[model samples]
Target: MTATPGTLVLAGTPIGDLADAPPRLATELASADVVAAEDTRRLHRLTQALGVRPAGRVVSYFEGNETARTPELVEALAGGARVLLVTDAGMPSVSDPGYRLVAAAVERDIKVTAVPGPSAVLTALALSGLPVDRFCFEGFPPRKAGERLSRLKEVAGERRTLVYFEAPHRLDDTLAAMAEVFGPDRRAAVCRELTKTYEEIKRGPLGDLAVWAADGVRGEITVVVEGAPDPTPGDLDAGELVRRVRVREEAGERRKEAIAAVAAQAGLPKREVFDAVVAAKNAAHGAPSEGKGLT
Candidate 1:
């Protein structure tokens, strides 16, 4: 005889304040048939603080062992055991672990659902002065400088606000790189500590933020960068395109690369931009003395 399948619960825990822990989370913790937590010790502390006792088994489900433990959790679900998945903070499977188990559960046609709670991404975006009507979450940047810069370059022309998760220690270097690629004047926000007592939010140009972060930052970090500004009338004129390409070339980008980047940024075809630059040079034109688009 086949056993009844159980529900897979993806619960979001408080990022900082314990009071933010939802009552539903408490009830779920107390009654779940199996609790799969990213950190068993942290889970213990949380349960203690909440004054709740689990009626079923509790197991560690983190990055290290998630691969091997997913099947076991799936079996529990298949056996009709209520499996509750919770991360250290925020929602599971978001720059955290839980993807494997959730995917397995879905493959088996087991019911999967989430208990909505506090989110760092949305919170930071809301606090950020930049526009958030359209945005994208770019998880962590690559650790290496070259790779990180390449990744940044890929989105250089992105018009939607960008959100990123970065380690505190690497904040300065990351901001510096962003300033280089995204321009020193690009606006951004640095959200730290979140809902904790020491929570802090820093908003300014990327260049200024880089200098501030150089002094050192602590706790969790989320960065929100304003998207590339929209081009205005005459923004794509031949003189404007030449100036844009030259600025990039002066920044050490190859001529070809600079032309391509300028094209993308101005929403123009590369051939048109390249021809414009060639035409400007042939006409003995140097950088524009003054123009609405030069800055």
Candidate 2:
């Protein structure tokens, strides 16, 4: 018996416009041996738009079905089925389902690939006018006040731009939490209904944005935040550096990242940062280097 070649295509459909669907996505959908979609109805709508009926089996692989569908999908992939995964918008597994399937495929050494599509991250980042060279995506923060604050505290000193997807109803509370945790002066932009007619970008300090969102805004929302400002050079001091680094490190930042951040803020080289960290470690153990400090 001949073995079939197995492949997993991670396809991207438009977040809005049907015309935005990439050619590869349509072709893959038309020929896939198994189409795993977040929503079968939306998939049908998409197929209708492309005028291409999938000539393969279709399966719903949404949040509710994700856990139950994985083993079955894995078995099919092991049998060399060309499983194509598509979500309702943008890409799958990003604030959606498909991560588990992707993880399973990787565990079994199955090939995985993507068909590029629209993203609220890039769209909001582009429109936010905030620095985007480096960024971190936080997805949606916790809905409850305490949990949300705890989460925000985790990224309080993040120097890279931050992106967040928020719901219309929670906009005010989320923005308020961001202001309190990230500081009222933090620069941020609120992007709503991207790629749609009512698309809007509100840019200002977090305090102002919080107030605006409090009045209630509708449609899809994407938020972009400017990173923490780098402290000026020559502000070196072991005290503040240790405080900042230890705070963030305790909040979940990796040691290496914490050191780098302290280095950036102290206007010190990474080597200097490393030396400071070592000295602090030594001090904690009653071995502070007497020669390392200023003469």
Candidate 3:
């Protein structure tokens, strides 16, 4: 790494309204020694809107060229080039291409930062009406049905709300798989063309949303799903609950949700399942239950 004063700055463009662009973004675009954009034409339009003309070099840094361009951008940073990274919309390196360059810059002891702007992730998340304390962002599920189903299987028992970016074309199938895996009654929201003209937010059970998507919609889409509820032992089938707990544990569910789902299904409280699990363990070790004599 060559000695340089330059830093890598990721600037978020607006997800919709051009006015949502942060003032600092325009300053960065104008002052940087280089601006790497996912789409140079879009960047030009944005720059024009801000009345800021870049005195720096502008290069296309998209998926197809990101791997090849990271090294060169790192070299520029080493030579004191103030490189500004921007995507077509939202932050770079978030299901975007700036991650590789950011990682490389850190490895070289180069400074890295961001010019925070609008994000569809937080925007849709805040509007989701689901638990906000904890959540995960799944960029996009695979386009293929089998692959998407397999991916949904991995997150079946996740307790935190989940967010996903998806193409409008595959929205129907993606939602169908979600309903199948997460249960038809799970709550979710479909946010489309957010912050733009004709913005629409549809909130309902996953099953209903799947049918709506089949009608064919357009524009960018963000999906938010509610987390799984806590478990109750009495809601479970004694034997089935225990078996499900084991199978789910192996498949990646926390001991708690597996137990909870079993309890819920059996119409029992969670404590009962917890006690049963403990008793089963003790029996496996040849230990007699103290309650046996009392009964």
lDDT winner: 1
- The global Cα lDDT (0 to 1) of model 2 is 0.85
Instruction: Sort the candidates on TM-score, descending order.
Output: 2, 3, 1
| lDDT, residue 218, candidate 2 | 92
In model 3, the worst 10-residue window by lDDT is 286-295
Q: Estimate each model's TM-score.
A: 0.81, 0.84, 0.81
Determine which window of 10 residues in candidate 2 has minimal summed lDDT. 286-295
lDDT of 2 by residue, 51-157 (tens): 99999999999999899999899888889999999998888888989899999989988888888888878889989999878999999888888999878876776
Clash statistics: count for each candidate: 0, 0, 16
By summed lDDT, the worst window of 10 consecutive residues in model 1 runs over 286-295
Error of 1 at 273 (Å): 9.4
Superior candidate under TM-score, 2 versus 3 = 2
The Cα error of candidate 2 at residue 202, in Å, is: 1.7
Give model 3's TM-score versus the native structure.
Answer: 0.81
Error (Å) of candidate 1 at residue 222 is: 0.8
lDDT at 261 for candidate 2?
72
Error of 3 at 79 (Å): 0.9
User: Model 2, residue 237: what's the lDDT?
Assistant: 73
- Candidate 1: C-alpha RMSD to true structure equals 8.0
Q: Which candidate is the best by TM-score?
A: 2
